[model samples]
Target: FHIELPMSLSDLVRLCGFRAAASPIHCRASSPPHSLPPAPVDGLDESLLADDLGAMELELRHRDAYLRSLGSPSAETVARSTLVTDSQVDQIMASEGPLDRLKDLYALNEDNEPSYELASVMLVSMATFTYLNVRYTVQERRLAGVSFEERNKLTVFASKQQASRRKMDYITMRALRLGLKRSASSLIFAPLFLGGAQCISAVRGRSSPLDFLPSGIAAGACVRGAHGLQPMLGGAFLGGFLGAVVGTVVYGIQMYCGLTYEEMRRYRLTERSERDARLMAKLSAAREQA
Candidate 1:
């Protein structure tokens, strides 16, 4: 009796010079099976093919997620996950105008520290003072019939006198002292007003249009308390009136805008996300071209 083996197995046995005493082995005489007709590549279902491709993409995403969990993601994974490249960030920062930068600097969030509020207020105060000073200086010079060239000469002379003999013109000295006083007042009042407003808001449990009135009154009373009770009372009344007017105007604007603080914040976030998406698409196209 003979047992037939595949040709390849028989050849392996022959090459190794192995023989089984129980039965003789012979190579099968039949030809090798032909490979199945390559799965009919021409008339395949397009929808089924698309579904398969989609499944493959999902599987790749899962694989990338797994790799990320292990903290050893591939370069391709990192590239796909990144929102923006370093160059893109640089371009965005460069494209920002001064006004945009200034807005960003002054922008405040609920989570921000008191120091941030203080700094923002200080900046506003400084800007106010600068504008007022410039206007005052121009008006005074005009009233004195001082030409631009003459003013420049006086400024130079004042600087020279101060440098050489520690003496400055009386008008220049007075202006300098006034600026210093205003700056000092700003430093003191900014914190007082901000703290009072925050305290009132916290006590109220929510903000209201009238929240500023008491805060302003307290701030004003403190500012004028050094003079007398009458002055303090007058200051408080004035402050409360101003605060109420400001609050009313602000509330009216909010009503007109048809959006609350939360809505505005969400809108800004949505806009930022859309902008980032556009930038990302542009970057991807550029990468594909490269």
Candidate 2:
């Protein structure tokens, strides 16, 4: 039913005949251009949606598994996992082989037992690498014009700490922290046997020796006018050997002694000569400030 309205002449004509006035203003006033509504309150992006979907799916599976476990597991477990895209799992499968190989090689009867052989190898390797690192650090300090007294004190302090801490640490915890990381420092260890083999085999090709060693054993000291000869080769070997022996003994004792590094470091401080004590005190202060 159409109702007639009492209106102005233009309004009546426009409504009854669907006509516009003789201008653009009349048509625009009735029908303005359309616009979209504002985006949603949730407004989750694609990545976030994927993340939430994954999380929700995991929770649902967990609950389903709990329910299935109450009586008997259904085919749902296999089916849900089967739905996973292959691309999502290729990387996981690729990395799984090494761990499986390790497990098989050790005959891991149960996950609880530690492989003592692997553990020892890892521990000893770490100790040796650290010792080598100390030597390198000393050489660097010397090249940088650091005084001999400074170098000597640093090395001795490091050695003393190792000696003190040798009695009471756990074999496994120490191995874990030191094991994987020490494996990466083959550079220093390689010089004896491979003599730059690792770097040579790298995809990037061999690096300049100076890039790593920095201090040339044949080069002069930093303080040119007042100096001694450069440190000779095999010098590090003596200190390194001592360090390795110390590390092994200490690790063995601590593993067996049930003592800890913390405990050893606690009472390790000793009485020194007045001059030595003052020097150590100064070093300690400098370290703390740094």
Candidate 3:
């Protein structure tokens, strides 16, 4: 399959030109040198990170000092002051004796609203106990084997049942009524407490006692215009009592359930730690893929 044909240099040059024209240059140098596009630096400088941490610590210290000057400590300062670490919290929660943890639970910050569920449970328990005690008393009378007339002379089981039912109903109703009362008191007194605190704080910051003149005038007008001192004081006392009862109920339930402040703190920390670990894992995987 050889057919030899002699070609001139001009023909060869023309062939090369045709091929060059047909296909455009595809080399990197043909276009601009696309220097690896600038990538974001993921690694932070150690010195800069350290400086940021130091600044945060200083700010926290300042905040702690300011809060201390006001006769209050920040939550972090309080936690640090207690000298309770995570391990200690865990140990307290895991302690064998209920009474052992009661102290810590009592000391826990419980600034929460009263739980209706707990109150209802308590009411039910009291009702049950009352019913049982009454039933036991009636049984001890030996009225069961007596004749109808004799039974009638005694407190009958049916009457006993009815009384127990009534007592239970009364207990439940009282619990619900008290819960409603407490909630109403909280709604009324919460604003008053906040306003009073603000006024006191304002008065404290000022030199003259009369700095609270405006608030005093407003409050005096309110007290005078409304039912006078007696009714107001009575209502305040009732509301305070109800609120205290509600708070005590909630506190008792928390103590029963072993949900101490330290336990709560520990749970929160564990959750945060778990979340941070997961986030770190995701970041590491992403970095590896990159």
Candidate 4:
């Protein structure tokens, strides 16, 4: 009739169907250290291993993409990587003989075409002035209440006339500028350089040779350090010679440019004549038919 005996915890757990789970703690407390969940039987975790491998593959893919985004090398980079050393460049430059080098320097190829450059510069300057003249002329006509249709009709003729005048102005300006520059340089620097050379020769106990430098006499006068008519004579002679040389050079350049300009002008005139002739012929034919 009294209360029943208290059930043990293990027995209570067993009654609750936790016998297998509870058995491990009991076994672990009493079992030897050599035992541990049967060593996982397969000794590997398939799901966990697959997760690690997938992470590794993803990391590898990210690394490859990052590398690919850095593009290929450029020309400069290639050049740096395959650099030509100074010694190699020197060797290449020195491969040519002295005579070959001199010929290369003086060769009349495209690179050495100073005349072409001069012509191009002259042409550009002429064009610039012509553009400015034409613009102002157009502006003036507009301000004078010229109608758009009439202005457009006259534009071609005005531009051509302005261009012709500018071409002549360009040649004249170039000649004056070149003449002044050459003459001034000859009068000033030539004497200094030539006189210094003469002094050097005198110091070397050698009589200065009478070279045909345009400013040599003037330079010689300065070098002579004399106090009489001799200095004046030397200076006058030098000035004349330098003036002549400078004049010759300037004249040559101007002549070349003038000839070129005249040739172009004649060609243009010829073209205009031909055009007029054709127009006249057409008009005559039309009049006869009428």
Candidate 5:
């Protein structure tokens, strides 16, 4: 639960209860509860029940899946329920006038050892940042979905976010374009570049501001190692530098905007609170099923 205190933004506001994910995604729709219908035949009623018994077996097979969707998980069930959001750059490649919600889904063979969890997260981050870019451009172009406030306090907040995203997106698209212009070796390096990008995004999406030097160094080292370069120091250094540059840009945005990723996340609490309220209302509408 988030608390509240006096503040200029909202005099009674305090932040808590929000958790940032390392990054990942997926889920499914809910189903109605099933029940056994009464048998309507005479002597055949016993036969019908025998058939019902068979139906029961089928239901039992999926019992765990049904229960798990309602919230709890059975021992055999995978603990997977999460949503990964898009960033400003992701928004540009993807949405609204002159903008689109660009997305690319990667197929994990499940045969290789690279963690699928991390892949899923990276995909979500890419998607999110693209969206942010689109949103920003739309606003700048005075395109649709740009809500102008009377006092426009929220306008400034939205503007800053959009501006920050635009700057970030500019750098990424520049890198991508550069890659396309280069030879096959550079093309092959794109994936390694992506991992470096992810390292920045994973930290950027969180509540706290991140230092880029660490991510740059780590991604650079990993890339160098994966490429089997002896000494490896050069690649690592370059990777670290790039990673830090990305991280530093985002850090500056956080400072200038006076809102950490966490504060921006709070803008979401109102939506969450409403969702919880709606959920409780539905829960009170029904009883437990067999």
Candidate 6:
């Protein structure tokens, strides 16, 4: 007798408890042929995923190292790369003395004009000269009529008498006041004289002795203008005569020495450098001893 099964083959396997007996070919055949297979899940191989993660971490570390190498150097690296060492810097600083500092204060560079240096030099010299002149003139006038013996007698009397002390004090104060006034005037006069002389020299395209005459005359006129016409004339005459004498002397010196202003300045700078070098050597020896 022949019989037909009502259930499917999968149901027959389940009923008969024959799961192991179910064939893969039969299972595949049971499904629709048009359907695709399911995709693989990611966590199937943990070691492979871990290996990939470790490779990415190593690459990131390499990239970070490269970026750091391209960045600015560390402080220690900069210090090592510097041209001047700390001890050399300290020595350089220590080499500059008071005189060097003073020279630096009035230092002239190529960009600076000669007129400025001339004016500064003249101002200092004239101030000293004016003070001495005023003091001498005052003392000379005070002692004009008296003989040498009489002056000695007067000095002795002044030392003994209180009234003479007041007179002596008056003379001293008067001389001081006159010296200060003339020195103050010289501060203004010297700059004007030098500036005017410089301007005249520049316009003429060369220096001349005659350049000082006009400058001195103008400076004297300005200074004495507040006094009177007679005083102004007298000052101008005196200034012109002195200016001419000074010019002649200066020209003579230049001719004798064969040195220009620039040459003199260079010589002075060389001398100063030598002096500074000697000073530096002494300081270095002293430091070594210490």
Best by TM-score: 1
Could you tell me which residue pairs clash in candidate 4? 214-242, 218-238
Q: How far is candidate 5 from the true structure (C-alpha RMSD, Å)?
A: 29.9
For model 2, the superposed segments whose C-alpha errors exceed 4 Å read 1-103, 107-111, 146-184, 187-290
Collision pairs in model 2: 166-250, 167-254, 168-254, 168-259, 169-254
The order by descending lDDT is 6, 1, 3, 4, 5, 2
lDDT of 1 by residue, 34-116 (tens): 31111123477999999999999888888777755655544464456544455555455556554553354336644564334
Model 4 has how many clashing residue pairs?
A: 2
**What lDDT score is found at residue 214 in candidate 2?**
23
RMSD of each: 21.9, 27.8, 24.2, 28.3, 29.9, 30.2
- Candidate 1 clashing pairs? none
TM-score of 6: 0.39
Cα deviation of 94 in candidate 3 (Å)?
Answer: 20
Q: Against the true structure, what is each candidate's TM-score? A: 0.42, 0.18, 0.26, 0.18, 0.30, 0.39
The lDDT for every candidate, in the order shown, is: 0.55, 0.40, 0.47, 0.46, 0.45, 0.60
Higher TM-score: candidate 3 or 4?
3
Write one digit per residue (lDDT tens) for candidate 6, span 80-141: 44334445544544565545434443455555744344645666667666776677657754
Worst 10 residues of 1 by lDDT: 30-39
Candidate 5: worst-modelled 10 consecutive residues by lDDT: 18-27
Report how far off residue 252 is in candidate 6 (Å): 3.0
Candidates in descending TM-score order: 1, 6, 5, 3, 2, 4
